[model samples]
Target: MGIEGLVAKGAGTRYVGGRRDWQKIRHRHSREIIVGGVLGPITRPDAVIAGQYDAGGNLIIVGRTGTLSPSQSAQLATLLSPAQAGHSWPDEISAYPWSGRDAARPLTKVEPNVVVEVAVDTATQGRQSRHLMRYLRIRPDLTPADVDQLQL
Candidate 1:
């Protein structure tokens, strides 16, 4: 079967039979995204600022990941480098996930070299994801080019 998975409703919710009601639970999906920047110091980024490339080779800012553990942050730091001159993205971006975005969180630019796999909600389209992406892992085998034109 092609079913992805089921979502658990919040606490204090009674099961109701279908009776003319409309509800949508955005399912999670894994996708490859380019690391356009970070939310903290490059040496130890708190989260990844995800992005994807357009047909013209320009990077588009997608959603970001949640805070990484010390080890997870260290693991990602090893593969990241500061963005070089003429980098596609700006030095910082205020963009945040639709659900949990902090007004004080910072965005630091990085070389779009690291490719990561993340789980995002289904409400997102190519431009960006509406929810915070759950970081899966670094994809050493795939390059940013491989994520080109991918739908969010």
Candidate 2:
């Protein structure tokens, strides 16, 4: 199920503030995504804008990574470069669409060739994850073509 998790409640149980009376039991999923674009600079990305190719061979924005650790940033820097002309994605994207925030910022388009791993909850809106994602590591052994394409 594409649900966050299951909650098991005791019969006739009264709600408590912080007693672990009910278990959230969130489901975290690890997935492989293409590095489409990024926040901050090409040399040191603050976060990653992940993507997955739909059945139409079009890249769909999937999710955003939380702030990158210095080590992660450095590792990504070695793999990413400025997207060439006629890139599949735009130069920037509105934050409001995915972030639910008022401020929109510029996104640095990347080559869309790097494949990396990320951790996300089961919360998804359309083709995109609706929650913050954790960047796990670069999958150097895998290519973008090896990433799973969306069913669409």
Against the true structure, whose lDDT is highest? 2
**Please, what is the TM-score per model?**
0.77, 0.85
Candidate 1 regions exceeding 4 Å error are: 1-25, 99-105, 150-152
Across residues 64-92, which tens digit of lDDT does each residue of candidate 1 receive?
88888899899999999988888766655
- Return the top candidate by TM-score: 2
Taking all chains together, the TM-score of candidate 1 against the true structure is 0.77
Clashes in predicted model 1: 0
Task: State model 2's lDDT.
Answer: 0.88
Model 2: number of backbone collisions: 0
Pairs clashing in candidate 2? none
